[model samples]
Target: MAQYSGFKQLLIYAVSMFIIALSFYQWDMSQRKQEERIHETQELRKQPLRETCAGDKETFKHRLEDVRNNELANLIVDDKHGIIYCYIPKVACTNWKRVMFSLTKDEPYPDPASISPDLVHLPNILPFLNSFPRSEIKAKLKHYTKFLYVRDPFVRLFSAYRNKFQEHNEYFYQRYGRHILRLYANQPDPPQSLKEANASGMRVSFQNFIQYLLDPLTERNEPFDPHWRQMQRLCLPCLIKYDFVGHQETLQQDASQLLKILMLQDNIQFPPSYENMTTPAFLLDWFSAVPLEDRRKLYELYEQDFRMFGYKRPRELLDG
Candidate 1:
């Protein structure tokens, strides 16, 4: 009886030890896999910027002109973290700015999403790199882990249109919609006056917007709105050595890597994207409304952006 009892005790002890060992092995593998994921994502984010600098030297030279101008104004500076972000409208600029606010200020918000979008853009809430003297701006640009996010040009254009035109955004419709209507509407002089235009509820069509964009004279009279402007022109990616370049396509992964690189993951999270806003189907539907010639012209207008960012011409916009 004593021998039987001893054998039973030994078996139980052996099984417990085996279970513990298995748990440790599983944990170690999990940790390693997570580390590998982070490393891969980091590499994916950095590859394009590396390729751009090496392969596109002449284009970089042309973009270098922006460095002479007060391009620092485009950047939102987080001096504490030694980070700088160039805010590009419609490319998650609001959330990026919101993250900046949380990073810079002590006022606690549980996460970036808790902050209102309107409040994020309020001047003086965040410090800008351009606010500093020219010499200081040069120093920060050289040392900071500067970054920016960009999206597909046509997709971004569509997002801007939907947000500004499709919705009941009176501000854009009044300011830009009327101007576009006056210029591109088939019926010449649709509204006799600005008040009449507003009262008539004149909205800029996607086609009208594209026509306005293709007109060289339009940009000469009034510069491109930052919303639809080329990211290359807006961010001056060539002039500045961005430590990380993120794409809006892989936003969650890229943003996760960014927070990890900055070591801020524990404190704040990037805002969730509006998936319904810029899907592949949404882009195809909108582009279908635009004629092929106009589509090609639109591509030509943003060709530098296409080549710089390594984005292929979206097949939806290509001639069949």
Candidate 2:
């Protein structure tokens, strides 16, 4: 009877070991399938961009001449991974810039969160597509895994205004904010300095910023500040065939899929996003300051961006 008990214990141990091995094999298979699904989903995100670019030949006619220095300046390149990210301002670009900087380091990349925001934006920190010769630029554009993120044109505009004008951003306040105040705020004698402007409680309203955008002189004077420039103009979606087109609205999922597509899901993680991101719900209050005529005209200005990036026209604001 004692010998029979010892045999039973041995049998139980063997069964337990077999179950553990089987579970590990199943887990490994599940991980691989999940990775494949992520890659497939990432590819699906580019379909809309392809369809839009193919149909929009009229916009492409001038692409050759339009591919200027400024146009290529935002295309941050990661040669190690063969990735080119066309970053649009106010479109989670800060975090993307951090990621680009982290890629430039040696193996065992530091966390993107560890990089300073100011350092990432410094032009010297990252190599842009424009810095390369025309031949190399063309080669990289063709061979690299190019990607860009877009946002609702108006919402992005509002966010830019709120950040630059509403907040105490001295650089923007000096360059564009002052001009906006002087031109549209009916303040011919606007304050000369941000400190003075803030001290007196003089601020550029959302309506004033919209007026500046609609004004012909704005672009004629110079390209719209990248912060407020149309995503189409900045990224030139028609000029380049981006493998992935992410939207700011779905940033977390899109960023995740993109990392998986690049096979960096295990190596790096996207930085945590802010909770109070701009939303469509806030449009009504913001647009309350904007007149209907100006709103329609503004929509016309960015109509191409709306169509190309699959952003629905805000009928409520435009119609009303």
lDDT of 2 by residue, 150-257 (tens): 888888888887888888888888888888888888788888889999899999888888888888988898888888888888888778888888888888988988
lDDT for each candidate structure: 0.80, 0.85
**How many clashes (backbone N, Cα, C below 3 Å) per candidate?**
0, 0
Predicted model with the maximum lDDT: 2
> Which portions of model 1 show Cα errors greater than 4 Å?
1-36, 61-66, 107-110, 190-201
Give the lowest summed-lDDT range of ten residues in model 2. Answer: 57-66
TM-score of model number 1:
0.82
User: What TM-score does each of the candidates earn?
Assistant: 0.82, 0.87
Candidate 2 at residue 151, lDDT?
85
